[model samples]
Target: MRGFGELEAAVMEHLWAFPDGATIPQVHERMQADRDIAYTTVMSTVHNLHRKGRLTRVREGRKHRYRTTASRAEHSAELMREALGSGGDPRAVLSHFVERIDPADSRRLAELLATMEEPPR
Candidate 1:
């Protein structure tokens, strides 16, 4: 696994792709279009996602429909926070990232900060 387990990433991708929701069979079919994972693999992956709080399920007939519990941006931010927290001080970690910001971007950030500091909305 590069970052997350193969099943986890695959399941998350499917959940993020469909904002509404999808059943296990739907996800399995989609995955089949790409690489051919077993149906049970998809089912258990969705179950694990549910347990991880990355997905929520609703019953539909005899099967359960799964949907993303959080938006992609929300999930990414949480993961970033967790990754940073895993190290030492977040400030120190962020400071390293800040130092590497492109010069043009740094200037833009300063301009935005100055505007934000101004009183009034």
Candidate 2:
């Protein structure tokens, strides 16, 4: 339910870009092209992501190929839900959230809310 740190977020972004999944070395190489990061650092970050249940891995010979357990949009929604629930008043939180978004997104949110079925009491 927690958000990712800088390195973990970068690793997740890279993995999300590759739908077929990527090995630690593959991720490290991609990361290295942009910055001077160590291979072991990427390896540790990927392993931590897997341990956090944010990623799923399959044995690819000696190394594990990793992919995100949820889509980027899904992860964002989960984080929003967590944030909403963390507050004492969800209504106030949602009100603030809606107020902060752009007009187009506000309209879209209204449209989505209008289409949702009411829960049975």
Candidate 3:
């Protein structure tokens, strides 16, 4: 899958922020408040995200409201997983990552690993 450009990431951030989803005008309006952005550019970005399976949309009257198909955390995790599996030594990659994380995150990761080892309820 092609990586997202700045505008694409911004659009996705807006959709993720608005769980109910947002129309192109809504996103464009918010973005334009910060900087000049063309409505068509936002529209095309949302359409591209939808086509890439990163977003889902539904028609509401004359407009389409878009939402992310996966939560940000899930999307990030998938990216990490893909990178780990991408012809590199997974163990080394993970070890290097773990070694670089802060102590708090390391502790949290340990806790999560412990929880995963628990039997199903």
Candidate 4:
């Protein structure tokens, strides 16, 4: 969301929520239900997302249906990775991040790490 403006974020959120892809009109309708927005605005936002490689679109009959190229979790992970890569000792960054997480999340992270360390079956 940090990398996108208001309209762009709304469009991306809608596409991610709909996974099956939606036409510009569908996205516009959803946005309209939430607040006032123009059809051309949704159309341009989706086209921009597609051009930026954040979304993919396919022509479905007379309409182009758009969907997220990456899931929300994947995008979040990428953002985290980018943050870690930004001029810091990766170990320290990870340690600080892990230290701040809640106990439940820490336990889950440990369990995931343990599972990752196991040899493949």
lDDT (0 to 1) per candidate: 0.83, 0.93, 0.86, 0.88
Scored by lDDT, model 4 comes in at 0.88
Find the candidate with the highest lDDT and give its number: 2
- Per-prediction CA RMSD (Å): 3.5, 2.4, 1.4, 1.8
lDDT of 2 at 4: 93
- What would the per-residue lDDT of candidate 2 be over residues 15-92, giving only the tens digit for each residue? 999989999999999999989999989999999999999999999899999999999999999999999999879999
Query: Which 10-residue span in candidate 3 carries the lowest summed lDDT?
Result: 1-10
**Weakest 10 consecutive residues, lDDT, candidate 4?**
1-10
Worst 10 residues of 2 by lDDT: 112-121
Candidate 3 lDDT for residue 118: 100
Order of candidates by lDDT, top first?
2, 4, 3, 1
Q: Candidate 4 lDDT, tens digit per residue, 2-120?
A: 36788898888888889698999999989999998888888988899988899888899999888888898988888888888884899999999999999999999999999999998
Query: Candidate 2: where is the Cα deviation over 4 Å?
Result: 118-121
Question: Once superposed on the true structure, which residue ranges of model 4 sit more than 4 Å away at CA?
Answer: none
Give the Cα RMSD of candidate 4.
Answer: 1.8
Off by over 4 Å in 3: none
Which candidate model has the greater lDDT, 1 or 2?
A: 2
Q: Tally clashes: model 1.
A: 0
